[model samples]
Target: MTRRSITFRLLRALLVLLALTVTALLTASFWQQRERVSTAELVERAKAHDVRIVRDSWGVPHIFGAKDSDVAFGIGYAHAEDDYATIQDVTLAIRGRLAMSKGSEAAPGDYVVSLLNIWPSVEQRYLRDLPEDVRAVMEAYADGVNLYGAEHPDQVAPSALPFTGQDVAAGFLFKMPFFYGLDKTLKQVFEGKAELVKTPTGSNGVAVAPVRSSDGATRLLVNSHQPYTGAVAWYEAVLESDEGWHVAGGFFPGSPFMLHGHNEHLGWANTVNAPDLVDVYQLTINPDNPDQYRLDGQWRDLEQSTAWLWVKLWGPLLLPVPQTVYRSEHGPVLRTEQGDFAIRYAGMDEIRGGLQVYRLNKARNLQEWQAAMALQAVPALNYIYADERGNIGYVYNGMFPDRQAGSDWRGTLPGDRSELIWTGYLPPERTPQLWNPPSGLVFNANATPFHASEPQDDLQPADFAPSMGMQTNMTNRAQRLQETYGADRSISRDEFRTYKYDLTYSERSALVATVQQMLALDAQDDAVLQAAQAQLQQWDQRSDRPNRIGALAVLAAMPVVRASEQQLPAVDLRESLLKAAANLQQHFGRLDPEWGEVNRIMRGKEDLAIDGSYDTLRSVWGEEQPDGRLKAVAGDTYILFVEWDKQGHLSSDSIHQFGSATLDPASPHYADQLPLFVEKKTKPVWFTEAQLAGHIEREYRPGEVTLGK
Candidate 1:
């Protein structure tokens, strides 16, 4: 989940200002030097019985197997065939061996892995904590990845061999909290390097129940705004087995279970939610002993460890970079400029993320789904759910620590007091939740949980403690959703689809506010500012291809929006406007350029002008290019629109910024969905066994399918 249901505007800006922060190039020499694995041996050891993979026309894998473990194995094999390089990169990052091949860029991530003590957490808890069935799925998936790596030595980092089940589990433990902005939090408090302009993280999720639908149907919008490429980006797949494991939706790289999507009976969408789950405690150090800290009126020895990173020095040679890490009772300690601050964030010692997701995949109804959510291993994400039973719901889910009532946990805490520490979380019922609201709708645009549904049915923020830091502000998208979706009663399925693609910025939006401020400026004294202000004032705030005002206003506010999540370089309204006007005149020979001309989507050899702006329901966040244009980099990555008809027949359609093969530019699937995405259209999702029969583009076993097939 990347969005909160409700939050305050001030905290939102500070949250943005606070933070910001992949891969080995495989070569022929690595292949030549390695002992290649035999395909026959892989076939013998994989144990993928009754596995039959049918790749749909869109090149999405629909894997079928006799057992649940077999389907997991097939998903591993199929996903590896599509994106083996990314699998290695994900696994490597988890194992803290990424620096061995990627060098300095990956070293910090490797070091964070050490600082978080993630591996030891996995080591201590993985085998013992995970249920045997879940462990089987993880182990089988890892084997599939290992088999792929064994077969294709050419495209892997040398240190990435021997892929294990822990790697798969670690990937979940590593990525879960980051999705909730843990990395951003780490950079703000620890790294001390504030990013000026960063791609923001947010998502859109809404569920419509039969009670409010015109045709008595249910709909769920699975739109997650993410970088078009990366570890957190979505990859679509359909996994099913005879053993009752059936799910289709999106998964990250190296995932065996769908992170968000639907099975036959139910489906859920995730938006990132930020509750005050992380606690920063200032440790009281011993006067004489540097390695000891005062806690509970007693000086305690800090646990010390060293992580050795094999940093790439040259070809086939890695330099060992040893980093010392310390831990106190407060958790992982960071020696900041001011003091040693320890972090006790949710999922710090988590290994059950995989299990939580697996249960969600296998859940048949809202009860099962809620039961699975009770695991509370995912830590945080805003969930919008819809089922065939005409039920629609929202859950502002988090592993909220049951901290003591006296202290201000929202701010820094006293590490010396054990009473300030929390040992458990509120039960599932205690988290903000809604079921079948009177309005029959639930939505979150990274806003507060208080406004998640119809006002009457919305969760009462007052019921929760102030220490939770639950947001109380509205995003441009959330405000717009209120104006549009909330205003609409008895929504049709077609209307639901159209509403999710709304591209208008709310009047309350920061971009619009910036423009308003520029308009209020005494621009009459400056010719350029006057001209720019006049143009922006004429804007209708629709980021469409032919809109002239959109180009100038979007560009004028682009700098600020890009850096919204971090400390911004004082962006003067008049200065920003004048610069934008100048860039427009210089780059395209006119200030009134079409929105698409300035905002574009660029892939390898495929560049096209795209529409949409940041924080819009139909969001598109662009990176400023050298030539004065903004290249679409993130926002609105994978979108899935699902509907259950009057008779309970399920149908789904989706679009991706890229294709199923996440990293392969040569594949036909790559860039295939761009036109659909840009056109505000969706491709049919073949969910049933009937849909899979003839729609397949290619079908073969993992080892049998050639690269780029």
Candidate 2:
């Protein structure tokens, strides 16, 4: 071969070698970077602190540590072991990165996150609004979650790694409003559609003072409902630290601190409260300049930014999707066919409710709890609290905007008026709250705060401002509570427990109303209809399993009754009844099938018959199967009964619809609680370490969490 050709060939070979070298170096650097930021390293650091988690026979974690932050770390680690996917999903959603993993379906959620400016606000307020101690707890929690992802690398999404304290903070800030129906409002804005038939989200929180309890013991029932498993499903844990953090109750996926449960001294429960905390301002925009909006008689520039969403195109391939977000003098702005509207919400700038919850958790008494609540970091909820001191209080808690009183606050306001933009909140005093009522009790089943107590001690509705948007709607559970307790001045412990699990639909309930409507219909000409009406009339308003009439009653009344309660009644109750009767007969080959045969509770490998209807005290709302039978989806998940004896000794009993290991089928806890839940039973909370000793399934530190053989 010629020397010139050989030289040329040699040079080309040299060039190819150089390119390969560079590529190898780049790949090595990427791997090194990932290794440098190893989340498992964070877990090792957490283990340096003294934290021990003891999983009881039921798979519930009883976490003990030297410090509160250590306990939080342990709880995070334990929760990840049970439901890592959900926890990761929650963090992904909060970071506006869910679209990157979940694709097109989750893009809307990412858009809303960016439109509402959640992460931006978190970034701005994380170090500013959140207290240092709260930040430490959240950081430890993030570290624990990251460690789990690091160890179980195959289980995590491609982009999710090294979860940060900011993720924990943002998760709390973003998901907190969902319990209060913020998602429903967002759906109205984005989809331009409202739910036709609305049923109240169920949570029955009742507190009875010592004076009202026959044995002079204070009792509180904490029953909050969510789907069987999801972002908001409850996971029970008992967290304790030598530094005085001892709490036992249920918490959501990403929350480091307990959501609703009790410390040794006192405990509280939360029910969703929807006051007018959000306002949409219709802005006058200049067509020529899209960035300009009118405010206070002058055209002003909108604060604009582009949020780049990394949408998943294929596996590991992300495509950039950019959306322009705008902010006006009022708040976050969105443009739609309706108009340019700005949403000014209470939690738009706040990211410190987690700290408030922590403070409430460590509270020792009613006064201490009240002091923590006065922070008002949480925008809205109904807080039902009880203490060892035999004091019970109910607060229709919300951040009441100090908006101008003369205008209709419930509807859209003009953005041009600067006064319409509320800059402050109503102080704690102005918010509707009752200390210890003369009736010695208070309850909220998503009902009006004005009727929280007995008639004599109930707050006068006329006294509060219309701008607060306090609901006047009553539910079957609320009416049942009132009639049960109001009938007698003092209630025994058994009665308190019995009433909580009562399966009777109240007389004032829409179920009764809808049934009455159906019975009143003229069916003289239709023999089939007469037979159905007669069966319905004999229902006895009971929802027990073997009751033949209840199956038909629940099927016929649930849809129409829920609608009637929400002011969206069915077109015809008689039509619904006829369809229900036909469905029942087709499925069971009889009009009067056993209630259990129709209504079932299905989980994992077990599908068992369940008793209860939508609005009954032992509420169970189920979805229909292909064969026309109903399978319970929601209504009751976690139920807790807290009682303090006359001598101030506290004992609590709790149960979950499913076991502690959320989605793990191999885990023994997956369905352990189902039988107890169906039979209306509760296991002891087992708060003290000594109480948990004999039941220990496994004990370990954060990285070392293991399932028992």
Candidate 3:
């Protein structure tokens, strides 16, 4: 054949080959799509477990089963029925895939998760690190969530599918770090700055022994200030199994066990402690090779990983956003405009937090509880424990780092020096703890752990090193707690409850000091300013209902306190004060209005003034709306007070800012607890099987219960 004729014939053959290849690609794509797990299959798997969930009048589920796994499965299904959206979000967040489910708005969160090496840590440690029983329970819980998503296809995201045991473990690995302020450290490094500032967010916990109570019963207050709604909001449940799994208290959306609450034998509470668990190190990059960083004066290549985040923009469309994350011998690497920094955070390589918590829930005595705490997997929190045996204890627990004995480790450290890097944590026993103090009372309002108990019974700060980064500042709540409970040698059950619900700040509180200073300001021709001063002068220092002076003080101080760490501008403070006065006048037609009238807890069609303020005994704080009203956001969500008699009998009561059903507005439980919460009342929390039976509204296993009144 001629050369031209051969070329034309070859081109024709190539076209045919291309057409066949396209057809094959299309066929494969279709097959892959069809192979994806369907909602029906997932639902069936979820229902395979024999777990029963009983709901009470308040919509709190009491899960029962023959095995621990069964109880976890039921708990997951019940929680999903109430808040599948949040559960989905939390799971996605843990997997570092939130951007895929929530869109670009979630990209930053995904980046942080990847930068923290969340999944790698879980993958490397999950199977071996998790106890056998705990793994079973977590797997069962994952199955239940997957089943719920399967049964309700419309509720599940497209790419999201049947979760596995690993997903459950990831949840703990991803969330626990943030509990101890690791997120704040990452944010600081990501912003290309280094400065340690005290945080305003905090929680309160207090435990009184029988000696301190007139009723001869030990009391433990579980008051954790968290966001009013969303993943961290409180959901009350009682998990029971003939196999010895029994608990009642608050848990987050996807948690398998009660995070803080009481069992038949004892009860406990947790307050966020800001002991420094994270350290940032400035790496010294080799001049000749940019990828190499010096550690211990030796240059080493940094381990790098590329993260692909599915940023959902709108509808089914998504963009794959890529981020370069690095890791080194220290920990996760953070890239910023200033340079690269490595973070060494507590529990970065630990995967036993859930196991430890599970053990704590099942502990029958103080010894067992102490053993659970010895796991040292939990990074930071002040735990207050009380038992029916009239035992009360407080522990400033954390996986504190054993840094170089004599080094300035509090601020940024030189990454080049491996000596400054820590690979393990101090044993739990070495951490500060006080058991059965002579004072008969212990408390921590997110303050320094050294002052957790009465003066003579408190822990000695000198015992711990400065490298531990223990907090030194006393919060207003801590001061108020000392002023009210510290002076009293003994307290009555009634007095204990009343003290926990105290809504007044001490006259000498920092907030009070600031208010007094503002009131002392010299008055100019600004009528609004003069009116505000007059209102402040008449204040009673109480955040109670119908107290008009609180509005003026809170409004004036909001802007000043909300300002950045930089010093507040004098002109801005004056402007804010005048504006606040105008707002008060415009809203109430006077410069003074009841504190309750200005602040409120609003949900659905219900809106009412709430009696509380930040740092008050009954603390509540939030953002203001355009209509000149404060909308509750955080400060008071789930509260539990457990009292155990000398006879080892357990009884408790709890209140949630909002009711148990987090999603359905039509459910009777949607806002049933709001009135009690606003009124500072609590309903009895029943743990006994008989008590649960008496309050049962419905009982069934997952995929069996019908959703309706």
Which pairs clash (backbone N, Cα, C closer than 3 Å) in model 3? none
Question: Which stretches in model 3 have alpha-carbon errors above 4 Å?
Answer: 1-41, 193-200, 562-573, 705-709
Candidate 2: clashing pairs of residues:
none
| Residue 653 shift from truth in candidate 3, angstroms | 1.1
- True-structure Cα RMSD, model 2: 6.6
The C-alpha stretches of model 2 lying farther than 4 A from their native spots are 1-37, 196-200, 564-570, 705-709
CA lDDT scores, all candidates in order: 0.82, 0.83, 0.81
Best by lDDT, which number? 2
lDDT of 3: 0.81
- 350 Cα displacement, candidate 1 (Å): 1.5
* lDDT (Cα, tens digit) per residue for candidate 1, span 558-580: 67655554445566666777888
Please give the lDDT score at residue 328 for candidate 1. Answer: 88
Quality of model 2 by C-alpha lDDT: 0.83
